[model samples]
Target: MEIGKLPNDMLQNIILNKIKHFRNDILVRPGIGEDCCAIDFGEYSCVMSSDPITGASNEIGRLAVHVSCNDVATCGVEPLGLLVTILAPVYASEKEFDEIMGQICDTAASIGVDILGGHTEVTDAVNRFVITTTSVGKVLKDKLVVSSGANPGDDIIITKSAGIEGTAIIAHDREDFLLERLDAHDIERAKGFTGSLSVVKEGVIAGKLGASAMHDVTEGGILGAVWEVATASGLGAEIYRESIPVEDITQKICNIFDIDPLKLISSGCMLIACKNGNEMLKALEASGIKASRIGKMTEDKETFIISRGKKELVSQPGTDELYKAT
Candidate 1:
């Protein structure tokens, strides 16, 4: 099952409400629906988030840091530090551990984030190596972009394409299927999408352009990100299915797998809701990122999609096609 939001059950209620005396730090403003925790550090507060790599057998180290950093990017912040933990099965070899750390080090260095501290252990939790990264970033509240800042009539923009992360993982895990339907060149081209599992560059550009709300399209893809932005901002949206940009490789893989590209995971795509979407789109394009105005925030309080002139209401996503493709 997909990981849903943690319910305010008895145990969570005690920790989040009763026991943890929530303090209103100067910079860390406590709020519901924000993806990462905000810390008030006087001059500039820091944003912190932790995420793990579980779906892919390969690229675990590279993806773990980028994914968590993407959460920080959604707020239009630069990730400055990272804490990574590696959990491996007892049967894992030293070579595998070294390779994983190597990937993490290379990726972290590319992004200019320091490896602060983390835990490493070998256990029987599962068969594959699992990597988790907690990324910390700093941003002024005025410069921060929030998902809850979308407003009525704001244009919704998506960068890159849909199904980028999901299709890449699937093409890697299910090589047999891809080899049968796609040529070696096509398969290699598809595998190259691993490098696209980051939206930090695009997020930085959008944040500088003063985007109203920004979200990274991850597990639930572009549609899911749109829903979250709309819900968080107390707004509605009218999205055009045809407006979403899908790559040729993603289209081929999704067609072969019979998956809905819209419901697939997309890490490269950053969803931005902005007052001047046209200007933001131009800024992203100049930065070499493909941006599309897929929809507009509405006052109807309903999220709907238009396909072939027919409008269909959409609910929150479930059973994301990323795992299914794998």
Candidate 2:
């Protein structure tokens, strides 16, 4: 299972079945496979998503809050509130725990998202601190955006660049090594990228500007997110490699690690399925976000990716390489 997702049967039996206890009051709108879960909350639908800060330990609180909020934003909705749960290992310190919570609260306040309620516990089952946040949002019934909303003939637009999140993490995690090779200015630029996590402003704008679907690139890089969107939508796409924007530092890091830039985790970037490609691109540009029409949605039933000077496919094997690489 190097690069593949858990087997469907195993997942359904061990994971999905546990969530099968649906009740009459709880309706699953737009179904699974979407970036965010949609629930009918009377007047407007609520989009919810959750994730834990397991890959990187530094900036655990800030990352946890933004990552959870990013998912709701991907559904073209603003995060209204967040529910966080922190599992602290027995050896965790009170000062460190308080600092993490303080960062989470500050991040939430900056984003105008409220912290609802969550559970905190000290346990021996975990060796490190794990913070998970569940975000809630409201999306109008008419303006719902799902990963499966992409249609043939729509244009594929990606904001920011590939591997932004991964680069930031590696730079922060390996600060000493990076400082040895790169200058202080470069390090500062990479560190500043953490602020790019939430795509709320751009997402809401794109939704208003006519994006058919929106997906945040995360665990799987741009390639993984694209594949998921296409597979879930029962569609195909062709994305040009040269059109993707990757910072020089990010490119250098990928070269050093021998990892495909497109296959790396990209939390700061958002994939747009634009019905009017030009207009969406312009809108993103006007908002100071670097966006480009990289490709087009297709009906071929096969995802195709072409790189800048490479003749081969840079697309993923319909699997997340993040888990394997880490």
Candidate 3:
């Protein structure tokens, strides 16, 4: 009933419950936190993930690639190719279609991934253009990292800043409104957040460094990702609100909208579960990526957040706050 991702309980009850295992090649089955599905391929496994771009009008092509690739990266897989599907309204013009396809081609080329065949049709089924991409990557069986591998005592690290994607979407989609309240420089900086959407570099580094689990922050934001990671691991987590990074521009925009930056859509940021937080931090920093140890896994199965000297139960992620704005 939400605008973004489906709630956990409803998802399990309605969708995940209906799927039945019929194939033996599926190494990794569907789950809440697991971003990509893995298929057995002997020495190596094929990881695949698909997502659609339905939030913003600008930069849809770039967003589709990064978001789908980020999911495969969560499994320590380097994306090799993509299957893109475009659904545009009947009123869509030829120039607009060219722009979308051009973006998809250019973004895929820059990332060194091929654009495989997919369907494209203009129909009255939707009002605006929607692009969905299924990214494929490969990883050695022994090196595959999973979202359910987090254990007690493992430190939780988050890369980049909270609401990185949400800020960029709002800045670009609502440019006129943002210009009314935010400074021109701030709006420009927020718009630049799109360039930082890809996590392939840091993701590979973290996987090599032996991260127990990795999840890309998406629709529900950082806090939502934490809850999903802990749930998937059948464990608990203690998130320190103060340690989570939030850029000044993000905070300002969130303030203008009266929303929590932590509850917004965040594609650029990633949540990592590992044994040694310091080591992971060092490795990420050496690679020029900003990261912080914001929490640790708990022995008990109860998720909570430490904010302003008070501890409160962390709620399950619902519709992202960004939906209210977009």
Candidate 4:
């Protein structure tokens, strides 16, 4: 019913409820906040996740790859392959299609992943161009991490800044409009946020450091991601609003668009639940990744964001702020 991801309630009641996991090999099945599914294969587990690129038209191919791979990385596995499907409108040109494929290939190569076979077609499908990518990875059974593994007393860590993906998308897609209110340099810097869109490095680092749980900040921003992690783990969280990092350009863009930065899509940022916050932060810093301990998991089943001496309950994430701005 929404432009972005389905509401968690409807997703559970209408979709997830209908699907049953019949095999014992399914280490991880479909569930709220569980982006990647894992299947047991003897000593190792296969991890996979699929996502579509629908928000920005400029870097759809790059977005398609990173989004799905980022999901797989939440399991702390390096993606090795991708299955891509491309559907283009009737008016789409050959050059455009070639560019999209080139981007996909270049990005996959950069991540050291192979481009598995997939379908491509030009039809009257109601779209400019839609690309869906399914990233595949593998990890030892003992090393696998899931989103529901978080427990009470665990510290919540956020990598990078909030609204990283949204800022890049808005900066690139709405460049002309943003030029009216912002300088060219600012817009250029915001667009460059795309370079930081991968969470695989931090994901692996956190996983290796024995993080309790990991979730990539995607359709929902930092707040939404925290809510999902808490709900999935049957726990609660207390997030310090001021501790959540947000880039100045991202904040300005969100302000101009009258949207909440905390509720925007942020694929580059990773949400980690860990028992040793300082250790994880130090590990991330050593890897040249910026991270912050923003909160802690609680036994109480109510998620709250405290700001300026006021505590407010965080609601279920709906449409991403990126939709409104774009």
What is candidate 4's local distance difference test score? 0.93
- The TM-scores, one per candidate, come to 0.92, 0.90, 0.98, 0.99
**Two-way lDDT contest, 2 vs 4, winner:** 4
lDDT of 1 by residue, 1-326 (tens): 24533322422365446544447773433333355777777777789888888778877888888889988998888899999999999999999999999989999888889999999999998788888899999988678787788889899999988988887788788878889988878778878898887888988888888888888887667777787778777878999999998888889888887888998878878889888988998898988888899999888767999999999987766566776666
Look at candidate 1 and give me any clashing residue pairs. Answer: 27-40, 28-40
Error of 2 at 53 (Å): 1.3
Q: Using alpha carbons, what is the TM-score of model 2?
A: 0.90
Residue-by-residue lDDT tens digits, candidate 4, 1-326: 67988899999999999997778889999999898999999999999999999888998888888999999999989999999999899999999988999989988888888998789988896478999999999999999999999999999999999999999999999999999999999999999998899998998898899989999999889989999999999999999999998999999999999989999999999999999999999999999999999999999888999999999999889999898887
Estimate, for each residue in 252-293, the C-alpha lDDT of model 3 and write its tens digit: 999989879999999989899999999999999998999999
Residue pairs in collision within model 3: none
lDDT, candidate 3, at 188: 97
Model 3 alpha-carbon drift over 4 Å, by segment = none
Q: Please write out the lDDT profile of model 2 over residues 1-326, one tens digit for every residue.
A: 54445443455477766765555534344333466778777768878988878777777788899888888887788889999999999999999899999989998998999999999999999999989999999977678777788899999999899988887777777777777778878877877778787788888888777678888888668877787677677888888888888899888766666777888888879999978988888888988988878888889677878876554543433444344334
Q: 309 in model 1: Cα distance from truth in Å?
A: 1.1
Error of 2 at 266 (Å): 0.7
TM-score of 3: 0.98
lDDT of 4 at 305: 99
> CA shift at 198, candidate 2, in angstroms?
1.0
Tell me the whole-model lDDT of each prediction, alpha carbons only.
Answer: 0.82, 0.80, 0.92, 0.93
Q: How many clashes in each structure? A: 2, 0, 0, 0
**Which 10-residue window of candidate 2 scores lowest in summed lDDT?**
316-325
